[model samples]
Target: MRVPHDDGPPPPPRPPKGRKRPGERAAEAGASDMSQEPGRAALSPTVAGGEAGESLSLRPQSLAEYVGQAALKRKLEVFVRAARGRDEPLDHTLLHGPPGLGKTTMAHILAHELGVRLHLTSGPAIEHKGVLAGHLTALGPRDVLFIDEIHRLAPTVEESLYSAMEDGRIDLPVGEGTRARTIGFELAPFTLIGATTRTALLSGPLRDRFQIIEAIEFYGDDELAAIVCRTASILGVPVSGAAALEIGRRSRGTPRIANRLIRRVRDFAQVRGARSIELADATAALLELGIDSEGLDMLDRRLLTMIVENFRGGPVGVEALGASLGEPRDTLESVVEPFLLQRGFLLRTSRGRVATMKAARHLGLELPPGWQGALDL
Candidate 1:
């Protein structure tokens, strides 16, 4: 979304008939300018290398192309077919998950399946009521508005969306002083797809507005291997099944990470003048990138090491750990902790985060005597 430029003074409240309005011209300009910006406005975040990157993006344009989240895909397929049969917009959907699990890709697939235009924006991008209003007013019937990181929306901006989402209209105050009056503008039917990593941060009313709430889980290793193979095909690189599986195993169960590893492995193979990616190449590439067999990167290892060594096997607070590591608490909780806890390296308790015995073993650290009793192990 483009913020209109100020040129001395604002345009007249009403432009002469047959002439374009300032707002219309600004919107047109924004549309044209979108191509110049790589990762802004309606452009997919996963896209890189500008237009070339868009063609190579691993994002699935349809549910048939999307991998994993099998149950969610089946549900969406039924919903899309039903909505199309009734000639109505799909219900507002809330997709919650950890980052890079294809929440954004799912939104794109929804729009494509419904055969509608998608307006992409983020919670933090819509700063106020006017920005929200601009998006709402510009929609055509059955179009989609995808908001990423929806939990971060400003309260006032979120409030403005209630009527639009529920009533298909928006109420805005017009004029000023004693002449001030409220205007309600009717809007076309539309779908709002919200993606968030932190569902608990959303207001109850906002959460209730969504008709379909789906949780996107991490991909299984097999599913990730399939995604890696598909990505390699898209990149025109040859990859062995064993290489793909190895990359998948080290991707931490995320397709985005799997694709990234594929590209790095391809680069490594190309540098070595190898004809195709092999298990040895994949292993060497990941090791060179500081990823261990357990898929733990340097940061992950550092977190575990800090807990085992500095915190004495950890019954430590995330804030304290963040302070010592110079990392944000949110990053620790959202990014590092989830994977570690999933892999049994860390445990969350009422008191704080604790390093499990598995973490000590992984780090090759020896706990003091009687540690089992102290940690209730």
Candidate 2:
């Protein structure tokens, strides 16, 4: 499908006869307007060496391209089709919940389905009010501004966005020093697509500003298997169906992890005098990588061990646990913690992190001090 280059109908009147032709003026005008948009040029900035022509954007493009989250796909399709028909943005969509579940890719798909340009950037990239204003100023009507990790938007920068999202207006300083006055610039009716793994950190007002809150849930066995198989095919790896399902079962419900595992397994198979991935070879390869059949990596098991042994299988604070295990809090929280918690291996208490009975029993360990009381409750 062709991208919608025309945001709307052409400017009504041509330039005067003495002036440059309307087409040249239009081109110049577009160039001038586009200069203010970050990540909005004809080319996208290098993401994980995508500048080298590698498929670093990694995320899929459509619901069919997106694996898993079937319910989300159904809802998104309705919203996409309806929004497209009305010629209005879908909404100020906020994608919450854990990472690596195609939140960013879904945003791109939403933009693509709407036939609008997708301007990508992160929350931290816009440091000041002016920078945020400039970015919004450059957006065409009904364009998409994807702000990844939206919970990290600084207070001042977030403040600058209130009016932008609410009224499609941005306040800019017209002059310097005492002579300066704030000027309100009208913006196109655009969509603010915010994504975050940590929705709790967002202010209440900020959360309310979003028109929709869609949480990306973990993938199921079938979804993960299909994702692995499809991803392997796309990367030109010869993968057996069983091997694909095996990899997916071990992917811990994450498509990104499934893709990563496929690559690792492919590498292993290539070096081990094998041209194709079979169940046995895949199992052995995964064993070497320290990813078990349960989809738990060695670090994941180590984290469980830390919780079971060092933290006493009870209420252990994340900071204290991270310090003991040398794990970054955010990484532990976003990647490892989500899977563990989802698998019913860990419990989040009002006090702190506690290993579930399943976790203790899985490790063949006894429950520790504090958990005994909570278990009774």
Candidate 3:
């Protein structure tokens, strides 16, 4: 099965020609960027309209706003200061870790700290080497190229980046069919900020080219609580510390998840005419949405079920498991499957996906009766 394209989901509805959609008003959560392209607009992160939601200006406006990543934050501060002091672009940096842990946040933050212009693009958007070369040649000195999901880059496009990164040059092909002249275009010194959730899948040659690689880990419950409360304050949602903590604990350690839950709770609060979101209100809201207390969503549980029942306490191929669930195989492969595999909750075997013994017992299902002879129950 092929990796999914950014075409992972359907595009959000565009405004009716020139008319705005209902429920989007000034100061509303969805009104983050009124001037954004009509096809995709998200007030909060997560893909709202096929494209990754959240705009450049919508990224946290300042480092104080970036929150968490204390150690990385300190190191990056020094790095940015040194580069800015010398008036040079920052080193080509890589941000890696689970999704929504602020990899993109750091990319934007770095650009903001350097006080330089930032140009945004992504790995998948550059389908061919020429298209990428076009963007590279356009970069100005001290500019930042922010590429999200860097691991998804096409191999040729990835190769093209090497010369540009190493020597501030983009080699372009002038003609086709073997008589092509290669022209080296000089690019102004620029910073390449790459963000990826699947760093392990990145090739050694690609990974080795980065000067600084920082992995963003899951925020602690307290950090998430602070993020939820801070975000609510920004959106003008009246939330208490308890309310904030409740939402944060169930957020699966992702700020994107915390911000999303806050929006949902705000809607509930407004509909019920409640004063604000409380612990109980937040719990009831999340339960209604099928996000369990432990942050397991419907798909999370379904993954366990498929491994336990269909795979028969043994390994099974990913494509077959994806087919069983009727999920887009690419979505399963890229977004959903990684977290499960990382938590030791699921095992990837040479044959396929296997349910860890811990996973089987957590779901309260009986182990296969016949498997007792082959392995301990």
lDDT at 136, model 3 = 83
Q: In what order do the candidates fall by TM-score, top score first?
A: 1, 2, 3
Instruction: Return the TM-score for each candidate structure.
Output: 0.85, 0.81, 0.78
**Leading candidate by TM-score:** 1
Candidate 3 lowest-lDDT run of ten: 49-58
Per-residue lDDT, model 3, residue 217, is 82
Off by over 4 Å in 2: 1-58, 366-377
| Candidate 1 deviant stretches above 4 angstroms | 1-56, 372-377
Whose lDDT is higher: candidate 1's or candidate 3's? 1
The sequence of per-residue lDDT tens digits that candidate 2 reaches over residues 1-377 is 97667678867786677798768789879967875655442322223432233244456777777777878889989988988889898789999867778878888899988899999988889888888887898899899999998888889889878888998898878889999999999999999999998888988888899988889888898898888877666665678889989999888888878878887787777666565788987899999999876778887888888877887776788899889888889888888888988887778888888777777666677765566423733
User: Please, what are the lDDT tens digits per residue for candidate 1 over residues 240-282?
Assistant: 9999999999898888789888887877786676777889999
lDDT tens digits, residue span 19-75, model 3: 765666544544556435354422333334322233333358667777788898888
Clashes in model 3: which pairs? Answer: 12-49, 316-352
Stretches off by above 4 angstroms in model 3 are: 1-58, 176-179, 312-315, 341-344, 348-362, 368-377
* Best prediction by lDDT: 1
